[model samples]
Target: MLEKDRFFEKVIDRIDHLDRNGLKNLIENLQQKQRVLQLVFEALDEGIIITAEDRVVTMNNVARIILGYKSRQYGNFQEMDKYIANWGLWNILKFLHGEEDIRKEFTIHQQQEPKYYLVEKRTIEDNLVLYKLVDQTEKKKLQFQLKNIESVAALNTLASGIAHEIKNPLTAIDLHTQLIQRAVQKNLVCLDESILQYIKTISHETKRLNQILNDFLLAARPRQLKLSFEDINSFVQELLLLVKPELEEKNIALREEYQNIPKNFIDKDYLKQAILNLIKNAMDAMEKSSLKILTVRTWYDNGRDSTAIEIADTGCGISPDQIQKIFEPYYTTKEYGTGLGLTITYKIIKEHQGEIQIQSKPGEGTSFTVYIPIHKGHKLLDRPL
Candidate 1:
C-alpha cells in the first residue's frame, strides 16, 4: 500500500510541472504580441492615443507631436488631460466616455491659422478607449475651392442663357448701323462732316460692342471640342509664334521648355484659345517688372496620368485674398478689361475634362498649370494665323 501511494504522488508532481511550463509559454507569447502592437502604433501616420478607463495609458509619437507634447511620458494622464483641455480636446474626451458614438470633424484655431482634424473615438474591451486623429486641413481647403468652382459653373450656365438670347439682336443692330454708315458715305446729301464722323464712330463702336459680346458668349457656352492626336510641344510652339509680336513689343523674354511629350488628345482651336489667354495674362502681369519673363513648359505628370502645360511669369503676383476670385466671371483688376479672358480660359479647360490650378504669392510671381488627359483618336488642325 505504501509503494502504490508513492507512485501516485510522483504522477501528480509531473502534472504540476507540465502545467507550470504551459503558463510560462503563454506569457511569453502574450508579451511578443504586445510588443508588435506597440511597434505598429508607432509606425502609423495618423495620430493614435489610448486611455484606460479615466487615465491616459499610451500614445504614439504622431499623437505626441500632434498634441504638441513630445516630451511627455507615455502614461502621463494628468499632464495630457491638461493639455487636451487647454486645446479644446475635452469635448472629444466627453464624447468617448458618453453613450453616443463619436465621429466628427472640426477646425481648431491655432495662432491665427486654422487646422482641421477628423476625430474618432471607440471603446474597446477592458474599458480601454481609443482616439484617432486625422489631419485634413489641405483636403478641406481643396473641397472649399471645388465648391467655389461649382458656384462659378452654375453662374456660367446662367450667363450663357442670357448671352444667347441677346446675341442675335446685337448682331442685327450692328449690321443695320454699318449699312446706315455706308449710305451716308455714299450719299453725302446735306450731311455735315461732323455728323458723318459721328455716324462713323457710332458704327465702329457698335462693331466693337458686338465683338465683346461674342467673346462673352463664347466663354459662357460649352465649346464643341474637335479632339485630335497631336504633339503638345509642337502645338504650344505654334501658339508662341502667334503671340511673338506682342511679347516682342513689350520686351518680354519668352522661354520654352518642352519635354518629350507623347501624342495627346486636344481640340486645336480651343486649346490655342486657352493657352493664348494664359500667356496674354502673364504678359499683362509682367508689364511693370524689370525682367519681363514668361516661361512656357509642357510635361507629363505621372501621378495624374495627364499632360501639363505651365505658364509662369516674373510678374507682380496677385494678393492672397484676391487670388480666390481670379477665376470668377467679370472679375478683373485691370482698367479697360472685360474680365472674360480667364473666365473663357477656365471654361474651355473644363470642357476638355482638364483642371487648371494657379499658385501665386504677393511679390513672388505666379504659375498657372493646366492638366489634360492623354488618349488616342484625338484630332489636330493647322490654322492660319
Candidate 2:
C-alpha cells in the first residue's frame, strides 16, 4: 500500500511539471508548424484556401490575387466572402459541406474579369476544407480559336462549291464571246478596227474574270480524290516534264532527289494541281534571287504508314509571323497574288487525309513537305492471273 501511494505521488508531480513548460512548448510548436504551412502555401503556383467549420482560416497569396484581395486586407475573410457571394463560390462551399471529394469547373467574376477556375475541394481529417483553384483562361481561349477556324473552313467549302457551279458557264460564255469577236473582226463591214479591238478587249477581260473566279472556286471547294496507286517517281517525273519549260525560261536550276517510295493512294489530278501551285510559288519567289535552285524531293516517312513529298526552294524565305497566316484565305504578301493558292493546297491535302508542313525564314529559303497515305488496296493496273 505504501509503494502504491509513492507511485501515485510521483505521477502527480510529473503532471504538475507538464502543466508549465509543456503547454508553452506545445503552443510554440503549433505556431512554428503554422508558419511552415503558410510558407508552403505561398510558394505554390495554384491558389489555395483553407476554411474552418464557420469561416476561412487561411489563404495563399495566389488565392488573394485570384480573389482580387490585396495583401494588406487578406486577414479579413469577410470581405472575400462578400465578393465571392455573387460568383457562386457560396454554392461551392455548400456542396463541399456535404460532399467528400468534390471537383467542378466554374466561372467567377472577380474585379470585372470573367475568370475560369477549376475548383477542387478536399475534406481534411480535422473537418477543414482545402480548396484549390487552377486558371483555365488560356485553355478556353484556344478552344475559341479552334471553333472560329472550323467555322471559317466550313464557309470556305461552301464558297468553293458556288464558284465551281459558276465557272463552267463562265468558261462557255468566254469561249463564245471570243469566237463572235473573231468572226466580226474578219467581216470588216462598215466598222473600224477600233470597234473590233473593243470587242476583242471585252473577250479578253471576260476570260481574265473567268480565271479569277475559277481560282476562287477552287479555293472554296473540297476536292474529290480519284484514288489510284501511283508510282511516286514516275508521277514526279511527269510533273517536272510539264513544268520544265517554265523553269528553263526563268533560269531556275531544277534538282530532283527521288527516294524509293511505295505506291501512294492519291487523286492524280488534284495532287498535280497542289504540286503545280507549290512549284509556281517557289519559282515566283526566286525572281530576285541570284542563283535560283528549286529542289523536289520524294521519300517514305517510315515512322508513319504514308509517303512524304517535299518541295523546297532556294528563294527568299517567308517571314516568321506570316508563316502561320499563309494558309488563311485572301491573306497574301504578293502584289498580284489572289492569295488562294496555298489555301486551296491546304484544303486538297486535308481532303486526301494528308498533311502539309512549311519551314521558312527571312532571306534563307522555304520548304513545303506534303505527306500522303499509302493506299491499302490493289494497284490500278493489277489484274487477276
Candidate 3:
C-alpha cells in the first residue's frame, strides 16, 4: 500500500480514541476524496457500475448514458431491468441476475453501424460486482479490413496467373508490330501517310500494353533484389534532378532536407521507383494549387531503429475515403492514371520490410512518410535471387 494510504488506515483504526475535532477532520478529508473520485468517474468515457447484493450501489455518468438511464426512482435491480427492457440491453440485466462473476458481450446492430461492448463482471468484494464496458467497434472494423487485405492478396495471385497466360500472345503481337515497322522503314510496302500513323499507333499501343503487363507481374511477384548499402540522400538528389525540368515548368518550389544518416541496405532502383512515385503524386496533387511547395525530408530515428523519408506538398489533400482506397490495385483519382503506381510502391516497401504512412487535410496539404529499418538482421547476399 502507499505510505499515505497506510497512514490513513492507521488513523481510521485509532478513530475510537480520537477527539471530536480529529474525527470531524477525518470525515471532511474522506468526503473531499470521494468528491474528487466522483468527478473523475463522471468524466470517464467508459461505463462503470458498482452493485452490491443485487442492489444498485452506484453507476458512473457514462453508464447512465449508455443505458439510456432516465431518472426512475429505483431502489433495486428489478425496477432498473424493467426500465431497460426496451433499451436493447437485456444481456446486461441477465448477467446481473446470476450468482458467479461472469462476462457478457452487448452488441446492438439495429443502429446505422454495429456497436459492440464487453460488460465484464468482477467481484471486488463479497456480493459487490463491478461491471465495466469497453467499446470494440473499431476492433471489429479492423478485423474486416484484415480480411479484405487477405482477399486482395488472393486476387493478386489470380492476376499474376492470368498475366502469365497473356504474355505469349502479347509477345507475338509485339514481334509482328516490329516486323511491320521494319517493312515500312524499308518502303517494302507502299502505304499512305494516314495508314503509317495508324501503324505507329498500333505499335505504340502494343508497347504500352506490354509495359502494363510487366507492371502487373512485378507488383504481384517479388523481384530478385540486388541489396547493397547505399546513401539514400544522393539517390533522392538524383531523382530530384531528373524531375527538375518538370518542377520548373510547373512553377513549383522545391525544398530538400537531407539529414546525415547511416547507409541502409536497400535495392536502390526499387526504392527510387517508390519514392519517385510518391514525388509524382505530390506533384499531381499540387497541379491546381497556386501555392505549390514540394518538401522532401530524410532523417533517422534511433528509437525506431529506422530511417524516414517524408515528401510533403502544399496542395489539395486526399479525403478520408480516397485515402482508404489509394493503395488498392487500379484505384486512382487522376484522369489518366493507370493507378498501379501506389500498388507497386507498396509492394517494394513490403519487400524491404518497411512501411509507408500518410497524413493529409482536405484542403491544406498531404505528407507521405516512409520508414525503413536502418539495419536488418538478414542480409541476403548480393546476388540475383
Candidate 4:
C-alpha cells in the first residue's frame, strides 16, 4: 500500500482510542479542508464538471452557467435531460460518457452575441470524468478585429489614390461650368434654353460627385488626433444639448443616462463628429416610426480600464446582413446616404486605438457602443501619445 494509505489506516485504528476532544479536533480539521476545497472550486475561472463512476454529476457555478443549467446539482445524466434537450449537448454528453478523452470548441449563440468556449474532457482518478471549459469569446473577437483592420487598411489605401485622381477632374468641371453659367448670365455668351438645361445638369452632377469624393477622402485618410483630457459625461451632455432642438422639433423623446466616468485623452472634434453621425442616423431611422425614442448612455468600466458611450434608438432596426456591412465604404441603405458616415466613425475610433460594438434586431431597436481607453496622468507620463 501507499504511504498515504498506511497513514490513513493508522489514523483509523487509533480513532477508537482517542478521547472526545481529539475526535472534535479531527472533525474540525476535515471541515476546514473541505471548506478550502470548496472555495478553490468556486474561485476557478474555468468551468468544472465532474461525473463519478456511479453516474452522479457534480458541477460548479461556472459550469452551470456555461451549460445553461439552472439547477444546483444533478444526481445522474438523466437529471440533465431538460438542459441536454435544449442546449444541444446530448451528443457531447454521450461522447463524454465513453472512456476516451475528447476536446473541442463550442460556439453558442446566447441572445445578442455568440460566445465561444474551449472544452476539454478527460478521465481522473476513480473513474471520475472531468470537463473543463474556458471562455474564448474575447480572444476570438480580438483576432477577427485585427484581421479586419488589416484588410480595411489595404483597401482604403488603394481607394484613396483612386479618389484623389478623380477629384481633380471633377473640380475642374465644376469650376468651368460655374464660369460658363456666369458668362451666360452676364450676356457675354449666347446659348439655347436646352443648352442651359444641360449646363445645369452637368453642374449638379459635378457637385454631387465632388461631395462623394470628399466623404470618401474623409473616411479613408489618416488623421492626427488633437488629444485632450475631457469628462466623458459632460462631453455627451453638451452634444445632446446641441441636438435637443432637433429632437424636440421632431417630437422624439430623448433620454440620457450618464454615470460617473473618468476623463480620457481624446480628440474633441473627431469624437464629436463620430457621435453626431450616429445620432443623425438614429434620428433618420425613427422618422417613420410611431414610437420614437433615443437613448444615450455613458459609463466607465474600471475593470476594462475603458469608458463607453452607447446610443440606442427605438426605430427601424438593422438586419443581420446589413449590420455586417454597415461600416463598409459606400454601403448604405438610405436613398440619399453618402454611405461614409459609419466608415469615418470607425476610422476615428481606430485612430484612437478604440473599438465599436453594435447590436441590433429587426423591427426591434439598435444600439451602437463606442469604447475608448481610460487614461491616467501617471500612466501616460512615460507612455507615448
Candidate 5:
C-alpha cells in the first residue's frame, strides 16, 4: 500500500509541473500578440482610434498626426477638446456614445473648412468603440478634376457646333441690314417714320445677336484667371445689394447667412459675374413658383481648404433629366433663354479650381453650391487667357 501511494504522489507532481509550463507558454504567446498588434497599429497609414467605453484607450500615430492630436493619452474626455475642435471628432464621439452604428462618409467642419472622412464605427465587448477615419479630400478633388475634363471637352464640341450653325445666320442678318440702309439712303424722303423705326429695330437686334455670339465664344474658350484676394463676406453683401432691387420687384425674400471667413484668392470680377448669373437664373426659376425665397450662404471648407458659396431658391425646380443637360450649350427650358449663363458659370468655377454642385427637385427648389479653393496654386485644370 505504501509503494502504490508513493507512485500516485509522483504522478500528481509531474502533472502539476506540466500545467505550470503550459500556463507560462500561453502568457508569452499573448504578450507577443499584443506587441505585434501595437507595432501594426503604429505602422498603419489610415487613422485608427480605439476607445474603452466612452474614453479613448489607444490611437495610432497616423490618427494623432492626421487628426493633429499631439497627445497619445486621451482617456479624459476633457483632454480631447483641443485636438477635436478642428477634426469635428465630437460628431463621431457623439454617435459612438449613443451606441449608434455609423458607417458612412461624413463631412466635418474643421476650423471653418470642411473635411470629409469615410468613418466606420464598430463596438468591441459591447463597450469599446473603434472609429476608422479615411481622408477622402484628395480623392474627391481628383473626381472633380475628372469631371472638369469632361466638361471642357463638351464645351469645345459645343463651341465648334455653334460657330458652324449660328455664324451664317448672323452674317445674313448683317448683309440684310446694310442693304436696307442703302435702300433707305436712296429714298430718304419717301421713308416713313414707321419704316425707319423698323430698320432701327433690325439694326439693334443684329448688334445684340453679335454680342451674344461673342459671349458664347468667350465662355467656350479657356480663360486666364486674374487671381485676386477678396473678402467673400463683404463681396457677397455688396453683391446682394446690387440685386436687391430685382428681388424686390418679384417679391422675393432674400436671406443671407454669411460666416465671417478669411479672404480667398479669386478673380473678383469673374466670380462676381458668375454669382450674378446664378442669381438671375434663380430669379427666373422663381417667376411662377408660389414661394419666392432666395437664400445665399458663404462658409469655408477646412478639409478641402476652400471657400464655398451656396445659393438656394424656393423656385420651380428642374426635372432630373433636364438637370443633367442644363449645362449643355443652348439647352434651355425658357423660350428666350440663351442657356450659356450656367455654362459660363461652370467654366469660371472650374478655372478657379472650384466645384459646382446643384441639387433640385421638380416643383420643390434648387440649390447651387460653389466651392473655391483658398490658394491660387490649386489649379487642377489649366485655363489660358
Candidate 6:
C-alpha cells in the first residue's frame, strides 16, 4: 500500500510540474481545433441541429438560415422550438424525441410561400438526436417546371399530327363550297337568296376553321431558323410602324423606349411574326378600355448575354389564375382566338434558345418580355456595328 501511494504521489507531482509554455501551446491547439470544427459546421449547406436530452447543444448557421432563426451560435432546440413552432417545425421535434430514426419529406404551408424540406434524424447517443435538413423548395420547383415543359412539347407534337390530317380535308371542303357559291351566282341553278347565303356561310366557316388548324400546324412542326444578324432596335422600329395606323385608329398611345444595343442572331421572319402577334393581342385587350396605352422597350441584358424586348399594355390585364395557363394550347380568352398565338410565340423564343415571361395584374395592365441571345455561332466583337 505504501508503494502504491508513492506511485500516485509521483504521478500527481509530474502533472503539477508540467512545463507552463507546453501546457499553453496544448490549450491553444485545442481552441484552434474547436474553431475549425465550428467553421466547418457553419459552412455546410445542409442544416444541422443537435440536442442533448431536452436541452439544445448547438445549431449551425445554415440551419439557422433555413429555419429563419436569428440566434445561431447560442440557442437550444427547446428554446428554438418555443418560437419555431410558428414555422410548423414542432412535429419534427416530436419525431426527434421518438425512439425510431426518421427520414421524410414534408411541406410547410404556414408561410407566405410554401417550402419543401427533407428531414433526417438519428440517435447519436443516450437521449441525443441529430437532425439534418435540406431545403428542397427550389429543387422541387425546377423539377416541376421541367415536367411542364415536357408535357407542353408532347401536346404540341400531338396537335401537329391531328392538324396535319385535317388540313387536306378542310381544303377540299373549302374548294367545294367556293365552287357551289360560284355556280349559284352564275345562274347554273335557280337558287334563292337563302340557298346562296347558306353556301357563302359554309365557305366563310371553312376558312375560319382552316385558319385555326394552320396555327396548330405552325406550332407543332420544327422550324428551320433562317438566322440573320440584325439590329434588334431597328427591327423593332420597323415593326412598330406597321402597327402605328391601327393604334392611332383606336386612340391608343404608343410609347417607345429604344436603347441602342448590339446586333443579335435571330430568324427575322419568325421574330417579327411573334412580336406582331403580341402587339395585336395587346390592342385587342385595350379595345374596350377607357384608357389605352401601349409601351414597347428594348435594351441589352449583359448579365444574360442577350437582348430584351418588353411589350407592355395599359389594357385589361389577365387574371392570376389564367396567367399560368396563357401559354397552354387551345386556351384563350378572346371569342375568336385560336389560343395558339402565344403558344407559337413561346415555341419560337425557345427555338432561339431564349426566354419569354409575362407579368400582369388584373384591371391594371400586362407586359411580355422576350430575351434573345446576342450571339449564337458568332462572337460579339465580330458582329456588324
Off by over 4 Å in 6: 1-15, 18-32, 64-81, 86-89, 102-116, 125-128, 227-268, 285-333, 353-385
TM-score of 5: 0.51
Per-residue alpha-carbon lDDT of candidate 6 for residues 99-188, written as tens digits (9 for 90 to 100): 578888988897587888998888888777788989899999999999999998888788778888888998999999888877767879
Q: Which has the better TM-score: candidate 4, or candidate 5?
A: 4
Better of 4 and 6 by TM-score: 6
Go through the candidates in order and give each one's C-alpha lDDT: 0.79, 0.78, 0.83, 0.84, 0.81, 0.83
lDDT of 2: 0.78
Worst 10 residues of 3 by lDDT: 376-385
Top candidate on lDDT is 4
Q: TM per model?
A: 0.60, 0.68, 0.66, 0.59, 0.51, 0.68
- Candidate 1: lDDT over CA atoms? 0.79
Candidate 4: where is the Cα deviation over 4 Å? 1-10, 83-86, 108-115, 182-189, 224-385
Question: Candidate 1, residues 240-342: lDDT per residue as tens digits?
Answer: 9999999999999988999997778788888899889899889889988887889999999887778999999999999988988888778998996788889
lDDT of 3 by residue, 1-385 (tens): 4987897889979988999998898889889988998999989878887877767788887777777777645456766765562255545555565756777777887468877877777899777878887777789889999999899889989989999989889899889888887998898988899988988898898888888888788778878777877787887898899888999999999999999988888888888989989989989999999899999999997877888899999999999989999998889888878788899999888888788999999888999998888666145443554
Residue pairs with backbone atoms closer than 3 Å in model 6 (clashes): none
- Number of backbone collisions per candidate: 5, 2, 0, 0, 5, 0
Residue 376 lDDT in model 1? 23
Full ranking by TM-score: 2, 6, 3, 1, 4, 5
Error of 2 at 46 (Å): 7.1
Candidate 5's residue-wise lDDT over 210-321, tens digit each? 7678668757776677766678988888888999998999999999998878887778788888899899999999999989999999998898778889999998999988
